[model samples]
Structure formats: C-alpha cells, structure tokens
Target: MAEKGMWPVYGHNTAVHLLQRTLPSPLADNSSQRGFGGPRHAYLFVGAQGIGKSTLAQVYAQALLCTEPSDRPCGVCRSCRLIRSGNHPDFRLVAPVNREGAVDRSAGLLRVEQAATIIRDSILSPLEGRYKIFLLQDMQQANESFANKLLKTLEEPPAHVILLLTATERTQLLPTIVSRCQVREMQPIAPTVIEQALGQHWQAEPKQAQLLARLAGGRLGWAVTQLHNAKFDAERQEQLETLWRLAAANRIQRLAFSEQTAAKGSQPQLFNMLEMWTTWWRDVLLAQANCIDACSNIDLREEITRQAAHLSQESVQKYIQTLKRIEGYLHHTTNTRMALDVLLLQLPQIV
Candidate 1:
C-alpha cells in the first residue's frame, strides 16, 4: 500500500474513473463494510499487459481499506493511512518470491508457498481495517498447483476477506478460478487517451505526443517507455528504412540485406528487431490489400505505399505469412541463428 497523497500512477484515466464509479454508494456504505455490497469476495481483472489492471486492483483495495468510508478512499483516513504505510494488517499481497526471499519484481508469479501463506493469513480477522483484501498481481503467472490450492479458499472466502486477481491473459488461468470471480476486462487505452494523458502529465508538444501515442499502440506504459528511450526514434526510422530497402530490391539484394540485418545484433535483440520488422511489413501488406484502415503501423503508411508500388500484393501476403511462421518458430527453438538464416533465405523467394 502507498501512503497518503500517494497512489500507484497509471496512464489510463478511464480505469481510474471506472473504479471511482464502481465504489459503493455513500448511503449504503458503513465504515466496516468493504467491497461491493458489504464485502462479497473475489474479483478478477483481465487485460493486456501495461493496461492498468494492477493499478486498478490497488485503487479498489484502497477503497476497501479506507476508514472514512466515502464514495472513494479518503486519503487522510486511518485505514487509508495504514494502507499507504504498507502496514495494513488486513491487506495481504500474495506475489512470487525470488531466490533471496524477496518478492520477485519481474513478472511476479504467485507460487504455491505464497498462496499457502495467503490462505493461512486469511483465517485470522483483520487487525485494523474492516475487511482483508488480497491483491494478487499477475495471476496468469500462477501455476496449476498454486491456482488449485487457491480454489478452496476462493470458493468460500472469509466474510472479511476479498481476493483481487490481475492478469494480462485470463485464458492462462483455470476456468474454475475464472468462474468464481466477478471478472472485469480492462481495455487498452486509446491512442488519443494516451496522448491526452502524456500531454497532461508531461506537457509534451502535440506533435511529439501524437508520435509517441502512435508508436505506443494504445499501451500507455509502452508510450512512457518510448518517451524515455533515447534511441527509439532512430531505431524505428532505421528499421523502417531497412524494410523498405529490402522490399524494393531484387531477390539477391533482398537476401543479402536480410542476412546483414539478421547479423547486426545479439540473438535476442536481433529476433525482437525482426519481429518488429515483420509486424511493420505485415501492416504494409495489409495496406496493399486495401486494408489500410485496419493497419496499426500507420506511421509507416507512406513508406508502405512506396514499397507496395513495386511488389505484387500476393507476394506481400506470402511474405506476411512467412514472417508469421518465423515468429511462431522463434518461440519454440533455441537455434535462432539457423532459424533466422533460413527465414532470411526464404524471404527473398517471396519477393
């Protein structure tokens, strides 16, 4: 829990607004009553990564723990104070631990031990707050054993306990767990929404904000990351140029260009770059097929048009399918060099 005047920052204003709307009404609320309708337990928030699922969970938890009991958390209340200090006895956070016994900060997976610990703690009454709120971030990372272990408690959670699970991919979770919880799907923030947020928080110039928003693909976290990344602009330009040159060239030159691009970075980085290139190329192919309205890589529209003029629409479509296959294979095999080499060799044939 964060302290007074401190809440986890998020880029999605609509999500914050949604939580504000979902909080129990002023007339029905009691200081001890938490969650919707006096603490009915367990909620699942599902969405894409970096789309504010975890942030929303925290906001809801804060609302549950607020002692003052307004429409939302009164930041100055005793319960809110406790939560902000991370000293709220009723608020338990179950997340994966690392080798050093610290919470694994990266892709924190909830393990059996952590789930057990949460279950053990749930048996007891809250030390201060009205109800116990468990904020489980990244539920998709929880293994079957851990998820199953959670089932019994989740099925019949304590009257004073609430379980809030956040996941980027809900399909990765067991259907049993999904069925027991009130699920809310968090949508990706629109590019315009992201642009407005960036402008408000960062005072970014309109043109720069629009560009960042376009590159972000409706993910504010990614937009923020791009804002901080010194080389993002240059790298995007270079990648676009490389794709254009390869697509426009003769078969031999295209193959040679692919090999050169493939050999430029470390295996993982090279693979990632190729993945981006492939996505951009696919968008170009789509634009060529008169699907320009559906293309995501709109920033490269002009370049796509330039390349599409020289290539047959069918050839571009074939290349797009080949790139999809290459992406699929990259996930399974470790021989990236060989995989990429073969992909590069075949790409020229598509042209």
Candidate 2:
C-alpha cells in the first residue's frame, strides 16, 4: 500500500523530491500544524502532459493519508494498502468516463457527473483513514458544468478532505476555483534527465533512446510512446528521408508530399505529420545556428548536418516561420486539402 505513493512509475526524480519537500517535515515540531492547519482542502498542480502531475497528486494523497510516515508514506500501513488496492474508502479518483459510460482507462477528462460525485462524497467524513483524498486529473478538460460542480466543493470542503486537481492548461480553470487552491507549477523534464532515465529504466538502444529523448521535447511519456509506436517511427523516417531527398535535389515536392500525407489518414494524423515535419525542420534550423542542444533530430543528425552545409541560416529561419504560419492555419481548422496545397507551394519558396 505504501508503495502506491512511492511514485516509482515516474522518471522525474527531482520533481518527486520537490513535491516531497512540500510535505510537512517530520523534523519540525510544528510540522503537523503547517499548511492549512494540519490538512489542506485543495491543491492545483499545473504542468504539461507527461510531466508527472497526476503522479504527484497521488503521492501527496498518500503522504496525507499514510498512518506511518518517515519522510514519506510507509507502504505497509493500512492506508497505503487501501490505496494500492484501489479500495481506499477515503480516497477517490474522479475522471471522465468513455462514450460507453465506463471509466476510461487512459485518464479521461473530468465530467460533470464525476465532479458531482466528488462533491457529494467529499462532504462526508472519511470511513477509514484520517483524511479523504480526491485526485482529479486533466481538470482543463472539465466542461463548464463540471467545473461549476467542482467549485461547490472547493468553496466548502469537509474536515480532513483534500482535493488535488491537475491541469496542463491552468488558465482554462475558473479563476474562482484557482483562487481556492495552493497552485504548484511543475517544470518540464530536462533532456539530459529524460535521456538518463530512459536508458536506466527502458534500457532502450542508445541511438534510438537519444533520438526519442530529443524528439519527445522533454516529455518522457511521449518519448516512451514514440519508442513503442513502430508504425509512427516507420512513417516518420520515410517522410523525413523523402523530404531530405527532395530538398537536396532543390525540387518543389512539398505540395505533392503534403497532399499525399494529408490523404493518408484522418485529420489528426495529418496534423501529427505536420508537427513531425515542423520539429524536423526546427532541428535543421538549430543545426544551422550552431545550437547543437536545440536539435531534436538526433537520429537524423547526419542528414541535418549535410543539409545545413548547403542551407543558409536565413533560409532555415524562413522555413521555420513558414511552418509556424502553416501551424496557425491548421489551428484555424483550415480546409486540410487547401492548407496542404498552400503549405506545399510555400515550402519550395523558402528554400
């Protein structure tokens, strides 16, 4: 049970330690009375996806509910056991259900009903532990109604109740709700930390791990996803090589490739491809600027190096700006076919 709060699944040790430091220190005689007078009613953890926000929420919950705490929750205690088995009467995790009205396994957004449940349950006294913990992940996805329902609980929480809400977009949350909680902003993992963690935990092939780490943009979850996504890897490699070849030949192949890639699958996949290309080109830009650390195309560093030799810094900057414009157009939900065509035509002009 105590192991549940150990946050072993997370690779960001520094973030975990930071969160731990926020706990009431056992060494302090007044530690028990610190922060909201021994128990907090609510907290907000703001960070990007895969930055261990959810995991941190759970860890804090464990520390709050742990019967035996020695700097951290003792996994062997009753409170820890209940949390581990997901049978902690005092601990509840509110998340969005799937279309089938089932709890989504993939950490769905919070819905109005889920918020209502938390509100209702939070008003009651804990049946087991001294504290009741509610963990709400992806709070930004909560609709207005859901947010409103949650706000009710935040305004008047029961004794010994704690609400932990996590969001990638903190501003999306209502200001009223934000004002009631202690907000903690989690930083993105550094590339070096991510690289080292991946090597230690996944034992990923060195070259592949390095490339994935760079491409993940300091998101360990995304890096792991890319490592496992064989299809995306194959397609990404193929598309990159095609673009490199066309650029090397100084040909206008952008429109054709964009159209072809857009037609390959759904709009989401097309956007993903566009994002991939953006990152790839950005790496080329960084390489041109002699900013080795800024490059994310480690796997294609050789190709980028070769291309940088012939491409001027101004050209890379122009392409990056063009890509940003294309992204903006996509954000406007521009017609995919037209957007692809226009972006494709503009690609060659940048070169």
Provide C-alpha RMSD values for all models, in order.
Answer: 5.6, 4.8
Best by lDDT: 2
Error of 2 at 243 (Å): 5.6
TM-scores for all predictions: 0.73, 0.77
Query: Which lDDT value does model 1 have at 141?
Result: 73
Q: Ten residues in a row with the worst lDDT in model 2?
A: 27-36
| Clash counts for all predictions | 2, 3
Error of 2 at 116 (Å): 1.3
Q: Write the per-residue lDDT of candidate 2 for residues 127-148, one digit (tens) a residue.
A: 8766778988778767788899
By TM-score, how accurate is candidate 2? Answer: 0.77
lDDT of each: 0.70, 0.71
Off by over 4 Å in 1: 1-39, 76-87, 96-108, 234-275, 289-300, 312-351
Candidate 1 residue-wise lDDT, 21-70, digit = tens: 55555456334345454545788988865667766787678886776666
- For residue 217, model 2's alpha carbon misses the true position, in angstroms, by 1.6
Q: Kindly report which residue pairs in candidate 2 clash with one another.
A: 1-80, 1-81, 2-75
